[model samples]
Target: MATSISFVGLSCFLLSLCLVCSLKEGYAFEELIESYAESYLTHTFEVSSLFASSICNHSTKANERESTFRVVDKYGPCFQPSLHRSVVPPSLTDIIRSDRARIYSIQARLSKNSGRRDLIVEPNSLGIPIIDGSAFDTLSYLVKVGLGTPKKDLSLILDTGSRLTWTQCEPCRSCYKQSEPLYDRDDSNSYVTIPRNDPVCEYVRRPVDPPRPINLCSYEISYGDGSVSVGFFSKETLTMSAAEKINSFLFGCGTDNKGPFNLVAGILGLNQEDASIVFQTAQKYNKIFSYCLPSSTSSTGHLTFGSQTPAPAGIKYTKLVAEKSPFYGLDLIGIGLGGTKLNIPESIFTTPGTIIDSGAVFSYLPPVAYMTFRDKFRVAMSAYPLIPGPTAAIETCYDFSKSTSVTVPEISFFFKDGTIVGIPGKYSFIEYNTTLTCLGFQDGGDKHSIIGNKVQRTMEVVYDVPGQRVGFAPNGCS
Candidate 1:
């Protein structure tokens, strides 16, 4: 029996090895053989039986057995599927130029709108456009998500700060310029309009003219950066890849959408909201997701869902405070310069707290905290000569032309759990040009404080919603 099983497994392995070598043109022969040998041992019993069955019928139909083996060998995870993987492509670096502008716009909006002001819009005032010439152009990370049957690929901005994933659909009353073709419901076989009675349809608040039929649910969402999307709330087949296909996935099909959306199709919301893609696919993914934002714009990063066990060692964990809805909030207690702790008031840090956002570029602090940090930073680097920033937006810059290397103090963030996250000088001071380096921190006024994407670079930030905490580990993304 042992001899028979060994023969079967060996025969199957050799056949698969030869087939893979012929089909996979670029793969090394030795590597392929080694991989198949490992696979054969892992699925030994199944492969032995499968090979015996195939060999028995090989004389009559050899092609069928070869094809079956090919499919089995190609997708190892398909046989025993695990976590869903999605690739987030890098965004245009020129979008980095719009970072300061986005910060200004957000600050202005927060100043005028205050708390819950943007959410409390009257039903009659729905159509009235509040036009602020503030451009919504901001540095964004993008991911290509396949939706609907037959899979229409859409480029969406990956935002952790917002909820409700939306895309511009056909039958557009008004729309913005998109690089890709708009998603047409007619082309999708699995498309379904969500019934108004469904609990998911409650997100739609716009009063229809003369009250249209309750069968079609509608939605309206306004962004803090002055971008608004109003359209139908519906469910369709959402495909992450060829292997992963989600049915009855609810998403906003924007009919009237306007924003500084650039050439992208829509937004992929990964926030802590019921309507978000992360929450909708919680059962499949276990409410776990993580990302490592690359330091350079040239390199790409990954967005993974489900399974957080493979994380690297020495990850610092902190509780995700429930103060901010949708946005992930962390309790920031104090700021430290080198080894010395800054004497800024605890109230300043606690009042607004610190929100970790992937959408924003620069880290922001309250006015008092910012001034204290800036003053201390300046004093620490008093010996170095100052230079004009590459852009008007960056105020603090230094001349690094003559020196081989510039010595700058490390800035650390003190959290409530007595954990300190230290930022190296290289990360805190960004190289604007060949000879100039500018400070990455900005004053967020008094109302809001944010830890932006620039600060998060090269770090493995794990958002473990099921565990109700966020974990961070050094990943060399920079």
Candidate 2:
């Protein structure tokens, strides 16, 4: 059976830590701002922009001035605190179920051969189709970004596979429940609605008897999970840090929305689209970005735009393959278990290639590859006692409760150009204390394979869009 955890208990736990850290010597004021931002988003606390700005100004270093944002995992301790560390952790069955649902939802969306459409077009230029709901409550990483005049801080899901940044606005025709209040346009002094006379508004169409033209720039976006967001596209001032702010930022003001958006205010798109937040600010940051996802849910990660000085040593580099899909695709040459390479056909990885998505929780591989890898892994772990055959979405699980340490073989991801990245045992297995651990990989059907966030943890993933390459380096993210 699945059980839900309370946010109140979690917030209190995190709040206590934040308070203690604020008084520490090495702790900077920015950490306090981040903690306050998390509390405001999760508990609806009233955090003033002036306070946030003051904290940022105090923490700003002379040489370290750049546009950067703090990224927190949705299930991280800072975001969702655990009641007790020694107590049995949240149900792995529940976590696996949610992860599988997300995978299925993504697969369904990819199955559709919807060709690329023009960015600006009639509302129905691309057929409006209904999506089936399967994976609704998937965990995602969140980032705090400020928008509007007085800088209303909003917690948005950080998505590398999406292109549009959006949030629910006031005067919503219909909207789903969210932890924070809907953004009120009237309160923003820098808010500017796209006028009907603007060329951009011509592409917007309204649903009516005659399909009349919309006076405001409108947009409708549908997700793989059957959730849809529809509203006018407008411009507002976007604030990143105390010193960084962008004017006339294009974003969707969702008036009607639905689905398991979780507790976030909206989605922040990081795809390579022209209108994406990353692209819009690329020039300012020199088209460079990197993120280090923590291995454990208790640690907080960071996402930075622009250059990272003195790049981490011994970084593995791979060319970013160009694909029609709005994801970062790479040629997966092979996968290795321990020191032995699996004799799987390379053709299985061609059709859909492999996508490295930060939003996905589980790594998915072609069925053949998955089975081969699983069999090899099982053989490698023959020494350990097998606990169970199946548990929800996970087929293989083990009981390490009686043992102090388990020796699991290393899993390696072989990419093109002879670039090999190995995964340590700690990363390959999901440890629920000293007892329970499960394989982090899953079967992603025969069509597509995805390198989910789980496998990408503790690695500094650098997406150099302009350079057309992605680099990976080991980092202690947890």
Against the unseen true structure, what C-alpha lDDT does each candidate score? 0.63, 0.66
Q: Write the per-residue lDDT of candidate 2 for residues 133-244, one digit (tens) a residue.
A: 2333455667778989888888788777777888999888888877666888989999998865677544333323211136566777765434677888789998978988
Instruction: Give me the candidate number with maximum lDDT.
Output: 2
What ranges in model 2 sit over 4 Å off? Answer: 1-65, 80-112, 116-136, 196-213, 389-393, 431-436, 476-478
* Number of the top TM-score candidate: 2
235 Cα displacement, candidate 1 (Å)? 0.9
TM-score of each: 0.70, 0.75
lDDT of 2: 0.66
lDDT of 1 by residue, 1-478 (tens): 9999999999999999888877677556666787765432110111111111111111121121111111111011211111132212222233234554444544543343544533532111001122445343444556667888888887776778656778999978889877678999889999998777777776545534312344678787775444678888888988765566779988888888887665667877777778887898899888887766644444444566775544645678787887564568888888877745689888899976677877776788898998899888888777777776644556677766666555667678888887777665556755434455667787777756878776776666778886877878775232
